[model samples]
Target: SGFLGFVALNSEFPQVNPAGSVLLPLLTGLFGAPVLLISAFSNSSNIPRQERRLAFPSVFAALKGSIAGFFVSIFPGISSGVATVVSSIGERSDRGYIVTMSSANTANAILCFFMLIAAGRTRSGASDALKSLNLVPSFQEIAILSIFSGIVAFLLTIFFGLLIAEKIEKIDGRKLSLSVLVFLTAIVLLLTGLQGLAILLSAIPIGLSTHFLGVRRINCMGCLMVPVMIWYTG
Candidate 1:
């Protein structure tokens, strides 16, 4: 039924000008909005005070993730999710798994640029957007910018993480969730107008059901994947 709904949406897709007109709002509602909704309505307690301690994973775990990420970068069909799952074989600790997954995602982001330069192909959305905008950079430029931005991002993450940790317990989760939902709706309206809002409104219920119905959220990906399958098969 979800797949059928996705098929029905294909007719509406062409009317939207760019596919992103549908995708941006639909995905936000399908994936993002439900999360906020749950947080808004749930009886979740305030976050616990976080300890200012770091738990670094073993070097071997990082190396394994990097290798898995590189493997995913070189392949067209393989996704980072799949790579992370595969790389997590024999993982015994939750912390190690978290570290491995994070490492794989980070490595995949950085290595994808090298893949783009080497193959003149877009392996990720960022690379695809760069290609679309005709803003592809040189190999050296990519290397330098990637490293520099990575360092900045790392620093910012640590800074903000500590800041958030200190104040997280004081935050009202429900209010924050409601605020985010409003902001998300506003952005959708701004970017795609009434039509996108309609799409977003339609998707929120479906997204909510995936959680309440005990179904996997990943199935929501069919909203995009099914359409792609139809396009290619046709």
Candidate 2:
């Protein structure tokens, strides 16, 4: 829905014209509201009484973090991409621009979906843990908190998004910096990407090793502070 909103607000095709921007928020709300409703319904649906007692709150916390992260990552990318494409195509009855951009988005979403499916299959232990943990939001207090938290997060997102939009509107795009810093950073990441991947892969083992040595995760973090600082400085 958010992605659809972005496309509506920033598409280059003038066929939709002024309606596009107006439709963005409306469609976003329409499509997105259902997800919350469905999530609530699904969380509340049939469950064993015993499991429901323990599952609801735990699942709520896990989903809270996961959903927040998912939106944070998705919203910015969609907004940025849409804005870039719109600005590039300009407003001159260019249908191809919007069509091509939308197609790209569709393709990207499909690829990401496939990647997630593949990744899900590989995470057997995590899957098992998830399966063992029931996810019924049964308790009244838990349900209320879940709804409240969602509302707060939604309001916060709107507030911040508007603030950012206002700030960005004041900027003169012609004077904006198009620096090589971004390119350089990308190149650096590309060159060292495999090393970073390896580091992440070894994270669990490294923690286990440290634990065996009677060292804490905090201690490991502290030990890496100097090197991380140097990397950042460079």
Candidate 3:
């Protein structure tokens, strides 16, 4: 019923316009702001000193994630979060989920480029932009670019992970979360103005209900899923 109501509510509003898409505010409210608010107010808000050691995840987990991402990219109405969940099936370790999700994200991005070129389908915003600009590259070119970008991104991730681990203990987690919440609000206001602000404020409570009700966070995806389902099936 909650999901249905959320879907109904979103259906009543125009999700996009020349100004901006409601996605920026809706996603921020559902995923970003709620987490920040929870972290800001939680008694255990202080972040622990993370270990600086690097470890390789299971090859099987990565393979599963890659497969899931490939399948997700071939279809519309499926999201990376859903693919991550699918990839984590039977995984018991936290490290497995971590690696699997990361790999899924990587594979999804790379495959979206391929999907854009091969099927003219825009699986991501970047692909949509490329399609709009008529900038789709050849298969060979995209593959080479994907490989190069992946290597660079992997190196950057390690560097930033280690750097953040070194300085994380000194950062105030609550204050950081609150700062992010403020920044997110400002961005929504700047991009979407008062109407977007109103949507953000409305959506935040719904996002919070997921936490308080002990429901899966993924259920909040109804905002997108329901609307898409309606559009495709209507």
Clash-forming residue pairs, model 2: none
Off by over 4 Å in 2: 1-157, 172-177, 180-234
Best by lDDT: 3
Q: What's the alpha carbon RMSD for model 2?
A: 25.6
Q: Please, what are the lDDT tens digits per residue for candidate 1 over residues 1-234?
A: 256346445645433332235556777887799999898888873566777765557788888888899898887634566568778899999878987898888888877878888898666656755665667788899889978988998889788988888888888888988899999898778766787787788888889998889986767766755665666689
Full ranking by TM-score: 3, 1, 2
Residue 130 in candidate 1, Cα distance off native in Å: 3.4
Q: Which ten residues in a row have the lowest lDDT in candidate 2?
A: 48-57
The residue pairs found clashing in candidate 3 are: none
What value does the lDDT take at residue 122 in candidate 2? 13
Per-residue alpha-carbon lDDT of candidate 3 for residues 1-234, written as tens digits (9 for 90 to 100) = 235334434645442344454566777787789999999999988889899898887999999999998898888756677789889989999999998998898889889999988888877756765775678899999889988988998899899999999889889999999999999898788766777777788788989999999987778777766766776787
Supply every candidate's count of residue pairs whose N, Cα or C atoms clash at under 3 angstroms.
0, 0, 0
Per-candidate Cα lDDT values, in order, are 0.75, 0.34, 0.80
Q: Candidate 1 or 2, higher TM-score?
A: 1
Give one digit per residue, the lDDT tens place, for model 2 in 1-234: 223323333434332221122222222223222223333345333322221121112333333333333332232223223322433344333344443444344333333333234443211212222323433222454446546866796689667755665466555332332222234233323433433223323333443454456643333332223333444578
* Candidate 1 Cα misplacement greater than 4 A, ranges: 1-21, 71-79, 82-92, 111-125
Ranking by lDDT: 3, 1, 2
